[model samples]
Target chain A: MLEQGKIDSRQAILLIISLVLPTAILTVPAITVKHAAQDAWISIIVATMAGLLIARLVTDLSLRFPGKTLFEYAEEILGRVPGKVVGFLYIWWFLHANALIMDEYASFLCSAHMPDTPVIVFFILGIAVAACAVRNGLEVLSRFNQLFLPLFLGLLLVVFILATKDMKVTRLLPVFDKGAIAILKGAATPASWLGEIVIFTMIIPFLNKPKEAYRVAALATLFTSFYLLVSILVAIMIFGPNVTGHWIFPTYNAVRVVSIANFLERMESIAVAVWMFGGFAKVGVFYYAAVLGSAQWLGLKDYRPLVAPVGVILVALAALCENIVELLDFLATAWPPYALSVFEVGMPLVLLIVALARGKGGEGT
Target chain B: MKKIAVLLLILLLTGLTGGCWSRRELTEVAIVLGTGVDWMEDGRIRLTVQIARPGAFTAGSEAGARGREPASWVVSAEGRTIQEAERYLAMKVPREIYWGHCIILVLGEEMARKGTGMITNFFQRDRQPRENIWVMVTRGEAKDFLETYSSLEKTSAQAAGFLERMKTGYSVQLWKLAEMLASKGIQPAVTAVEVKEAGITPEPDREKKSPPQKQVGLAGVAVFKEDKLIGWLDPYETRGLLWLKGEAMKGVIIVPSPGEPDKAVSIRIRRGSTKILPEYDGEYLRFMVRIRVEGDMVEQQSREDLAKPEKIKTLESEMADELKKRATAALEKAQNEYGVDIFGFGDAFHRKYKKEWRDLKDRWDEEFSRAEVNIAVEAQIREIGLLTKRAGVPEE
Candidate 1:
């Protein structure tokens, strides 16, 4: 085994959430709200279901080749050359997803809190920290996430709760006004965010009890969708339909508006803290996967040597968006069907079907 | 030791790269307390800001050293838009301008009339002054409001902010303003303000009272059509607008006493809720508004045995009628005069008739103007003062 560390089922669940949640709350609300209007939350529910189905497909396939990562199973099921091509796509997807996570966190920080700071500073600091975690391997990443992700989520919940005074339930009125098409379109945008659960394929082989992969998928989906739902729903309730669609970061803006007791204001500082931890955890997960997958694809003995060079490449990729507007356009429209859905769900489903058809890796444990 | 090395590396990375890139020292930035926007004669925007003097805010540090210097500095500059004007204004300030502490935004009447769509959108898009700032419309130039020194507070902006906080008037914050501006159903309105004469001040050099020292006063609400200011709603009409909108009603309502026609009765509205029900006939639309209120008798000028059941009933009816009249006046002004639905009737209609709203959404103000509005009120007397009647009046 190239990697020796093991994470229990609960830690697996936590790691999956840490992967999907942080950036999901930031960009998904703005993108989803624009498509679905007031029904963005309904879109979120639909997206959650799609995400769960994808998670299940990926989990079932990874379990069939017990203790084997997606990269290894691709080689077993598709044979060497073709499987390596598929393996390269997963590697690219991991890099692209990590780049996006880093880009969004930096974009938000620059525009919201530190405009004078160049975006690359955040890129360097974020990826540099994440690289160290990647080099230390999965245990360090998941354990750090376990300690930080909960505290981050709690702060977000507090921000929403404090903003309850300003929230008008009527803002969510006239439900289904845009009908099913808009809701589905809205769901499609965040579906990519939720579909990020497919990363569980990488972690399933590392779970101490491999059968617990189903529990991991179910729990991560529940947490990711719940986080997306509350943040998007709270944003719509607080900012209304027309207003919610226009903000680049409606959740952060909604968080900023939380003024309680004349003292609990400017709470976006807490938001910065949450994003920092989230970005670190998110970048950690994807960077680890990318490093680990690349090592396996090349048949390397250890993944640690690839960490620094990959970090440099990831930073360069993170800068490709140019700015938040470009980044958002890519995330909302360009990335979903072509990149996230295909790799996260479509490819996994195809691979699963192929494996079943050929009777490859049949409960080989 | 390994953990320490990793911790040290992480600390050095954040300490060296992330925080320093955007680090701004407190002394390097000018803290703005209020922002003022006025329309120039050429239709350009003249941005004015009130910056608090750090030394003056230290309680007594600048006591006599800066004899007549106000506690804040005011500066103005002009450009085609707020950003351009801000850029010009920044040329004059010695330090980088900061808006985090700016608690108020004043719009000159001219700017409010010409249109505030762009101005509201500016606040909506920007990150600073992030949303607690209360917006107000001044009857005169916003520059004057921002420039005027205050004896009541450290600065005129603080004084005007205090006036809005008094809560006797309709005030909207930046977020609410943005929402209202973006929302199609409800037009926007904000607290109206004006420069007023507070008292005369004697000048040692002139030996005469300086033009009665100016202060900012709360002046009703400035209503709007889309983002253009249409007109003002007086205090009475504002109260009615509040009731029609179903917001919690405050302030006092005075009515003529039932039998004692020569005197007046005062009721302090504690809290109330309103329900706006919309009805559509074959061709026309009708809105039924039900307002339920709870109030206390704060003052009774006529001793008509006010606590008696029949008298209380008469008093309640009179209160209800008075409330209905105010609300009707507000509705008429909104419909017949301005034709702007600031009461959110369009929203109420949409909430009920989601299908019909598709067609009506475009021409809502027209539909709102033509709709028939009927207001119903129910008032309850929650409490009587120390005595069932006036203290001076003979008890039954």
Candidate 2:
């Protein structure tokens, strides 16, 4: 084994949640609303179901090869060169997805907090902290996330609750205005977002109780969808569906709209702080998986040496976004099926079907 | 080794503490309190901003020391666009401009009449302006309202914000404006401000003549037809609009007594709600505006009320009649004259008649103008004051 770490089932669920939710809140509502309009909430629900379906498939594949990662089992299922190619593609996927997450983090901080700060400044600062946590091994990163999720969720709930003052039921009227096809078209963006839950394939090997992955995945999916659902719903109710589509970060704008007796106002900092916590966790998870997966592919004695060089590469990739507009343009148009769903769901399905036909592993757990 | 490591950590922390280029100190920024926009005659935007001077705030708590130099400074600049005007305004000010605490966005009468489409788009598209800031249209120039003095609060912007919170007229914030404008079958109507003379409290002395000062006060609301100011509604018409929109609160309605000609009774509107019952009968559409009001009989000049239920009934009927008249006048103005659906009756009709709305949405203004609206007000006297009759009259 390249690493020795054991995280409980609950911690596993929280880790998966930390992996998906933070960036989902940043841009999903606006992108979904662009296609779905007033029916964006319906699109989000459909996307959640699709996401859970993919999570189930990916979790099933991980269970078929218990106590072993996809990298290890791919070699067993297929021949050496093909398995290595699949493993190498996943490493690239993790790095690419992690870089996008970093890009989202910097874009949000710049617009919501400080607009003039250089993108490289945020890239360096964000990667430095995330890299530190990744080098601490999986258990340390998971435990650190355990301490952060509750605070992040608590602050998030507080903002939404205070934001209820502005909610108008009339804004959500004329339900299903855009019809089913538009709703589905809107669902594509967040559906691809939810598919990121396939990161569990990389983490199942480290779970103390690997058999609980299915139940944990289901629960985490439910928990995460509730947040995403309420986030878009409140944003629509407060800003109206058409207006909600105009904001860059509707969730943060929703938080900024809260005014309780005028004394409790302008709490964008709380939203910013919550996202910062999620950013660090999400970046750490992908960074750790990418580094560890590369070490496994190369048969290295230690994975720590690759962390520094990989962090440098991530900084370079994150800087690829010229500005927030270009970043959102990519997220909205091109990245859905190609950059995200391919490795997260496509190859995993093929690998699972191929293994099922050949009947590889799972004889003696 | 521990001491050496601690020193190294401190050195690194020192080098990394000051944030990136966006970092700033408090004294280096000018806090914007109010923003006013005007349309110049030569097709340009005139931007006026009320910036708070923190140094003048410390002289508060003493009676005579305040208002000597004023607590806020007003400045204006002009350009082809709002952003250009703002850049010019920025060039004139030494400190960095911060809009985190902006209290209001005021549009001048000409600007509102010309169009508020660009202003609405510009404000929401910006990252700094708040969603809760009050949006109002002034009778003359917005710059005057921004510069007008406020006696109750330190600044006119704060005073106008407080006025909106009190629901003086039809209160609309930036978010509400955006929602109304963005949603179909509805239009935006915002509160109004006008510079009026607020006479000094004490009587003017013969020797020392004090100059009359101007104060920004709420003056009903400016009604819009798709972001262009078509007309203005006075306080009573605004109250009627409020009642039609289910927001009537903290207002008073005076009704004539049943039999008496100049004698009347006063009813304080505790709360009210309006329901739009859209009826589509295949050939024609009719809207029944069902308004229910509950009020307190705070003062009465009629002498026929000595603990009598009949009097309350009659008073309720008369109050209902008054409400109907006011709402009918507003309906007449909106439907017949201005021909705009600021009351969101179109939304109710759309919610109920979604199929008909598909064809009617393009020509909703005409449909609204032609549609028959029936106003029915159900007014109830919830409570009477302690006295059943006149306060100081002896039992006769």
Evaluated with lDDT, which candidate comes out highest? 1
Residue B221 shift from truth in candidate 1, angstroms: 1.6
Candidate 1 lDDT over residue span B1-396, tens digit each: 999999999899978796564577988899999999999889789999999888777756646665645689999999999899989998999999988888899999999999888886677677777676889999989999888888868888888877766677787888888888887788998888888888866678786657788888888789998889989998889888888987647889898899897899999999999998999764689999999998998998886778888888888999999999999999999899999899898888888888888888888999999999989999988887777777765546
List the global CA lDDT of all models: 0.87, 0.85
Candidate 1 ranges beyond 4 A from true positions: A363-365, B1-20, B61-69, B199-211
Model 2, B55-78: lDDT tens digits are 766655325544345779999999
- Separately for all candidates shown, the number of backbone clashes (residues 3 or more apart, or on different chains) is 0, 0
lDDT of 2 by residue, A177-275 (tens): 767898998998888888888888879988988878888888888888889888999898888777889888888888888989879988988888888
Least accurate 10 contiguous residues by lDDT in model 1 chain B: B59-68
Q: What docking grade applies to model 1?
A: medium
lDDT of 1 by residue, A1-365 (tens): 88899999888988999988998899889888898898888999999998888888888889899888999999899889989999999999999999999888888888887787788888998888899898999999989999998899898888888989888888887889889999999998778877888788889888998877887898899888998999998899988988888888899889888878677788888888988998899999999999999999999999999999999999999888777778888888898887665898878888888999999886623
DockQ of each: 0.78, 0.74
Relative to the true structure, candidate 2 reaches a TM of 0.96
